[model samples]
Target: MRLSRYFLPVTKETPADAQIVSHKLMLRAGLVRQTAAGIYAWLPLGLRVLKKIEQIVREEQDKAGAVELLMPTIQSADLWRQSGRYDAYGPEMLRLVDRHEREMLYGPTNEEMITTIFRDATKSYRDLPRTLYHIQWKFRDEVRPRFGVMRGREFLMKDAYSFDLDEEGLKQSYEAMFVAYLRTFARLGLQAVPVRAPTGPIGGDLSHEFHILAETGESQLFYDAAIDDVTREELLAADASTIARLTRLYAMEAEEHEKVAECPVPAERLRSRRGIEVGHIFAFGTKYSASMGFSIQTADGGQVHPQMGSYGIGVSRLMGAIIEASHDDNGIVWPDSVAPFQVGLINMRADDAACSAAADNIYKQLETAGVETLYDDRDERGGAKFATMDVIGLPWQLVIGPKGLEKGVVELKRRASGEREELSLETALARLTAR
Candidate 1:
């Protein structure tokens, strides 16, 4: 993508309403714009990042043996009513009435709808174990939606529903998703700690919330320091035993930690920090199926309610959570895996014929090599171009200038660390395009 043609509206001044680091940085970086109090329109740069995150979530879900299918944003109110949650769900539920005098709603979650679909489609015990997932927009009427996408009323979510014949099957599906969440966060360059959490409105007996540590986080957490020692490789290689081991580690939110009279970890081993929740999984046996009278035939030919579990990863909120955990004073320090563009190719002297030719040649080489590069061909000052590159936070910046070209070398700088190296144009291209 060329910056000259891109619709990036980056600003130097931070919005006064943005209280958190992610919200402020997101605005300043021109990733998103607020259309309403709790709704945001994702700009071009922001949409790229959002889609990248969504794809990662989708890939991880697929690895967990979940099949993908899309669900509608709007759902029939009769679904929630059958689940007995329409009245009890409170103001967050965006209730609506259609012209035909029928009730409807923008679904906050798809437990009721998914249950109906799965129940009507499967009748025999052969379809006992199935996990279906969807990446879609969800809406909830938050009373005070703030902190940008972190607590937005309208957001993208990756929700997976697992249907099993019994409690044991549900546990297996839940563990699979738990491990999937760990791997997903690790790939996204986040250290997510899974802590036992209350089911709340989901009404599950077993639940876990995955949180990323950040000072600006809303939830206070007490966890074993050993949790931090686990590497991304270890998480990616995780299995049922690894999942079992991780769950045994001490990790809980403030509310849950306060309920315990005896703290398990030694004072030195126990660490306290603030956290932003990015994912949640619930093993709610027969909650939706029983409530909605959804039943299937068992092996013994008896009617039985299928056990269900729901897993959710906040696809949109992750951008804010990642920024909160990764940004520095300069701007966002995007993880290479989730970065919109792998390299920011800067024509430092766009007005100079030599610099423009060199930068343009390198950009063409990068494109041919299948690199996602954002070439800054704008007729702007070198300082402004550099600043834009830093704020957007691509993993690398390749600067082309007349002086460097005259010396037969170009500058390659890593965004995370302010480290730069001057190498021959051929060498720099080789380094970037190397697999």
Candidate 2:
């Protein structure tokens, strides 16, 4: 992508309505624009980041034996009626009427719809233990939708549904998703702590919300400090015992937290911090299946309601969460795994032919090497180009200038740390494409 042809509408002044750092930075960086209250049009740069996060979530879901299928944003209100939640789900449900005067809604969640799908498709225990997922947009009528995408009324979500024959099977399926969530967050360069959470409308006895610590987060969390060292690989291979070992540690959100007297961990081990919720998992047993009359034939030819679980990761909200956890004073310091572009190629002297030729050559080399590079070929001052690159926060920045080209060198700077090194053009290309 070349900045000269890009549609980035970066601004020098922050929007007064943006109360959080992620909201302000997202606006200033030209990632997204608000079309309505809590509704946004994801600009090109923002769309790239959203897609990257979606793909990572998809890959992790696949690794956990979940199959992918997309679902529609709009659903029949009868689905909720059958599940006895049509009246129970409050104003957050965006209710409406179609041309035929039939009750309809933009789905806030898909539990009832998925349960209906499973019931109609499967008839016996042989089809048990199936996990299905979709990445799609969802709408909720938030009374006060603020904090940019973090609490947007319209957002992208990765929601997975698991069907099993019994409680034991449900536990196994739930563990798989729990571990997958840990690996997913780890790969995205986040330290997500799984805290025991109350399943409000989901109506599940067992639930956990994965939170990333940030100073400006909305949720106050109490957790054990040891959760910081848990690795993705370890979680991937974890068994029931291992999963229990990790979950046994004290962790809860502020609403559920009682007191230090009730905490299992000692004062030294317990840590309190503000965190943003990015993912949630639930084991709802037969809540939906029983309510919707979804039953499968057992080995003994008896009808039994299939146990159920749902796992959700806020695909769009993660952009804000990542920024909240990772950015500095300059701008967003995107983690390489989820950055919109891996490298930002800057033509520091865009007006100079020698610098332009060198930058063009390096850009071509990077393209040939299968690198995602954004070339800043705009006719702008060197300082302006640098500032824009910093605001966007690519993992690596390749600085090409007349001075560096004349000396047979290019400057490579790491965005996370303000560290720069002058290396030969060949060496710089080699290092950038080494991964």
Candidate 3:
């Protein structure tokens, strides 16, 4: 991708309605455009980032031994009626009447639909403990949807469902999703703290909301400051005991905070911050299954309703949440794992012969090395090119200019740190690919 050929539109002025930093930044960056009060059209740059986040979620879900499938964006109201939520669910449900006056809706969640799917084929305890997931578009009609993609009406989401035999089986299946969520957030470079949250519409006895701390975040949380160093490997190496230990270690929502006598830490050491809930998991036993007649024969020759757990990650919300968690005054500082492009090749003097030649060489080398890069071959000024690249914020920047081309070296700069080092072309490529 090149600035000369790319469609990244950036604006210096922030929109007045964008009350939050992430929202403001997203609009200024030309990542999204508002089509209605709450609906947004994802531009090229935003779509690229969303796809990257989706890929990371997919990989983590696969690692957790969950199978993937696609579900429809629209569903029949008959399923919701069987679950007795057709009238109970309020305006958030985008209900409709079809040509034949049939009830229909753009699904806000897939509990009713997934239950219908499961009951249609699954009929035995042998096929118990099945986890199926899908990444698709979901619609929830928010009355006052604002904050860019953070609270959009139509957004991409990854929702997975697990079905098991009984309470004991439900607990194990819940842990599998719990572990999977931990790894998913870690791989996306988010320090998500699992906090017990109230089950809103998703009825369940057990629930956890994953929050990433940021000033512009929506959820207020209490968590251990040490969670900043949490990693995916810790979650992947976990079992039943490991899940309990990890959950018991520390963290809770504002309502669940403890004020008892315990490990004494100063008030400043106790970190309470605002965060956005990117993902949530809950175990609702026999709720949808019982309503939909999803019964299977057990060993004792009796029909039983299966326990189910649902896990959700806001695939599109993550783009905004990530920006909220990790950005500076200049622009978005995309984390290495989820950056749209790993390396940005800047030809400081794209019109000049020597600089263009050197940049072309570097771009080819990076491509051969299997690096995702954007070559800024545009005839923009050095400051303009640098600022645009900085706003997009690739993990690394390879600066090739006429002055540096004379020295037989290029400048390498890390997006996180402003420091720059001049290195031989060969050395620069080696250092980038080595890691």
lDDT of 2 by residue, 43-160 (tens): 9999999999999999999999999988899999999999889899999999999999999999999999888887899999999889999999999999999999999999999999
**Rank ordering of all candidates by TM-score, starting from the highest:** 1, 2, 3
Task: Report model 3's TM-score to 2 decimal places.
Answer: 0.95
Task: State TM-scores per candidate.
Answer: 0.99, 0.98, 0.95
lDDT values for all models: 0.92, 0.92, 0.85
Weakest 10 consecutive residues of candidate 2 by summed lDDT? 233-242
- Per-prediction tally of clashes: 0, 0, 0
Tens-digit lDDT string for candidate 1 (129-172): 99999999999999999999999999999999999988899999
Task: Give the better candidate number (1 or 2) by TM-score.
Answer: 1
Off by over 4 Å in 3: 224-233, 236-238, 255-270
Candidate 1 overall lDDT versus native: 0.92
Identify the superior model by lDDT, candidate 2 or candidate 3.
Answer: 2
> For candidate 3, lDDT tens digit of each residue in 199-238?
8888978999888878877777776666655566775565
* Model 1 pairs in collision: none
Worst 10 residues of 3 by lDDT: 260-269
